[model samples]
Target chain A: MGDIQAIAKQFTDFYYSTFDSNRSALQAVYRPTSMLTWEGSPILGATDITEKLVSLPFEKVQHKVTTFDAQPSSPTIASILVSVTGLLLVDDSPNPLQFSQIFHLIPDAGSYYVYNDVFRLNYG
Target chain B: MGDIQAIAKQFTDFYYSTFDSNRSALQAVYRPTSMLTWEGSPILGATDITEKLVSLPFEKVQHKVTTFDAQPSSPTIASILVSVTGLLLVDDSPNPLQFSQIFHLIPDAGSYYVYNDVFRLNYG
Candidate 1:
């Protein structure tokens, strides 16, 4: 349980920092079978997903995580279900958009990669 | 892939409806090891989690799903990752709050159950 929390914290910190600094670098976290749903549009594979992310309208972006929760998915499958709520600033925008994201991370060779990812902007 | 979408839709619809109408009925979808993080607080197991859900401050609540995304977690594990964004109405309040939730559904004996759930309010 402590290990789960620690990895969750470390993963979130690394994820957001990498996203803010270099969007393309996120490809390391995905695989060929990975799927990413960005604003309801599904993108498959690591390269295509990374391209979709890099093609977003914003040149600069920052994510401030408000809260996150992580849990082991199944007893048989070695995976982590992580959910995050955050505020996002894009392209130097003064107003930050509240967002929600979920990442299904699967174990690889001594590491983890995103198997499923979903991102949404929570707007009223 | 198509089955994943259909199941995701059915699950979310049934979930929020059951949540609004009869919160206790949700226990069927949870197991002993299931975990729910509601508003950043972790609730473990079906009975305790259902109790926590039923004990929320509001007597009446409704969830209006804005968008949802789903993906299969792994080729070996028969599970789906479902993420949802929605507007939430508590009681008779006119101002609705936006919320984001993720559900990790794992297949059981000819059925599916909630293995992990995370809920967060997207407040600015």
Candidate 2:
């Protein structure tokens, strides 16, 4: 069996390191064929997902990974939770919006990468 | 150290045992002084939280715990994620709501229980 803790740590580290405008790092942690579904709509693959993340209309948005959880499957497939707080750049906007996101990750070659992710925005 | 996998299992088992009208089981897994914060407001202890969950204006509601993760702390403290899908019973209502909940849990004696849980409803 794989080291579930180590895999979980790696997953969270990669997730936090690429949050916000870190497009290059984001590219590294996600599989090329990765898909992100937001609000129940399929948003295509990693490149498109990256583009969508970067294209959000924010002057200085910030993403903070608040918590991470993972369950190891085999040596490759793992389920992960990458909770986040996204701070909008709009001056009059409220504080960071809280989101709890789940990612199904798979190890590719020597590196671990996200395979599928879904974000749920918290609003009571 | 406690078996992380076992701990994770126990936590999730307790979480899903009473997702809908099963108030008795819900009352079991949570700490007596547990606090649940919906959105940003503090909702007091487990009794209050259970009351709120049961009082939802739905004819038939169901809660399903999709995934679980835990990091053990000492013999008492652990961080848990109880990802969920909540189905509303209202006519013409949406299928189910997706939520990723992060929980701070503590083991009392031998049983694991949730201490603090925050739910983030995923819309987008």
Best candidate, TM-score-wise? 1
Q: What docking grade does candidate 2 earn?
A: incorrect
- Give the C-alpha miss distance for residue B43 in model 1, angstroms: 1.4
Predictions in order: chain A TM-score = 0.96, 0.72
lDDT at position A68, candidate 1: 88
DockQ-based class of model 1: high
| Model 1 stretches astray by more than 4 angstroms | none
Question: For residues A23-110, what per-residue lDDT tens digits would candidate 1 score against the true structure?
Answer: 8999999999999999888999999999998888888899999888888777875778888898999886899988888888888798
TM-score of every candidate relative to the true structure: 0.96, 0.48
Residue A44's lDDT within candidate 1 is 93
lDDT of 1 by residue, B12-98 (tens): 999999999999899999999999988878889999999998888999999999988899887886788899889999999999998
Q: For model 2, how does the per-residue alpha-carbon lDDT over B18-108 read when each residue is reduced to its tens digit?
A: 5654754576666556766565445656788888766666655555655444433222234333344343234346666656666655556
